[model samples]
Target: MTIRMAQESDIPELAQLYQETVLAIAPHYYSDEQTHSWASFAADGVRFREFILSGTTFVATDETGILGFAGIADDGHITSAYVRRDRIHQGIGSTLMQTLLDYAKNHRIERLYAEASEFSLGLFKKYGFHVYDTEIVERQGVEFKRYLVERGVIKKD
Candidate 1:
C-alpha cells in the first residue's frame, strides 16, 4: 500500500471509511448508543470536508482502494485517525500514525496531542503517547470516556 497526502476527491471515500470504521470498531469499546452517536459525526459532509481540509490528511491505498486515513492539524493536534473496518489490526493505523508523527517532526511541531477513545488508547500508547487527562464527554447526546494523550517531539539539530 502507498500512503500520500489526501486529495479533495478522496473526501467521500474517507467519510465512508470513517463512518464504517467507527460503527464497526466502536462497539467493541462503547455501548451501541455511543457507537451510533459517534458514527453520526461523519454524516455531516460539510463538517467532515472542512475537517479534512483543516489538516494535513494522509490516506493509505492500494490496488483495492483506501485502507485508512489520518490527519494532524497545524497546532499539533491529531484530528482524525481511522482504518477501514476490514483492514484493522494489519498495521495500517500504525503506518498512518507514523506518517503523521514524521510530518509533525519535520514541520517542527513541539508536541502532538489527541483525544483517544478506549479502542485507540493502545495504539496511542504504542507510539509513546501518554494520557495526561481523562474525561467523560457527551457527543450526540451520548456519554463516553476519552483520554487526552500527548507526546513531545524531539527535534534533531
Candidate 2:
C-alpha cells in the first residue's frame, strides 16, 4: 500500500468508501434508522471534496484504488477517517492515522481531537487517544452515542 496526500479528484472514491464503511460498520452499534440517517450524506461528493480540501487529508491506496482516508483540520481536529469495508483489519486505517499524525506534527500541532464513532473508539485508543466525553448525537431524528477523544502529540527526543 502507498500513502499520500489526498487531492480533490479523489472525492468520489472517498465518498463511496465513506458510505460503504458506515453502512457496513455502523450497524454493529446503531439502529437501522440511525445508520441510514448517518450514511445519507455519503453521496455528497462535492461536500466531501470541499471538506477534504480545507484540511490535511491523506489516503492509502493500492492497485485497487483508494482503500482508506483520513483528514485533519488546521485546528488539529480529525475531520474524517474511513477504510473500505473489505479493507478492515489490514492496517489501512492505522496507516492513514500515521500519515495524519505526521502532518499534525509537521504543523506543530500539540493536540488532536475527534468526535469518534463506536466503531472507531478502539482504533483511537490503539493510537493513545483518550475519551473525554460520551454524548448522544442525533441526526435526522435518529440518535446514537459517540465519544469525544483527544490525544497530545508525542515528541521524539
lDDT of 1 by residue, 4-110 (tens): 99999999999899999998898988889999999988899999999898889999999989999989999999998899999999999999999988898899999
TM-score versus the correct structure, for each prediction: 0.97, 0.94
Residue pairs clashing in model 2 are none
The residue-by-residue lDDT of candidate 2 on 29-101, one tens digit each, is 8888989888887766666678778888888999999999898999999998899999999999998888878
Q: Which stretches of candidate 2 lie over 4 Å from their true place?
A: none
Score candidate 1 by lDDT. 0.92
- Local accuracy by lDDT, each model: 0.92, 0.87
Considering summed lDDT, which 10 consecutive residues are worst modelled in model 2? Answer: 42-51
lDDT of 1 at 94: 97
Candidate that scores best on TM-score: 1
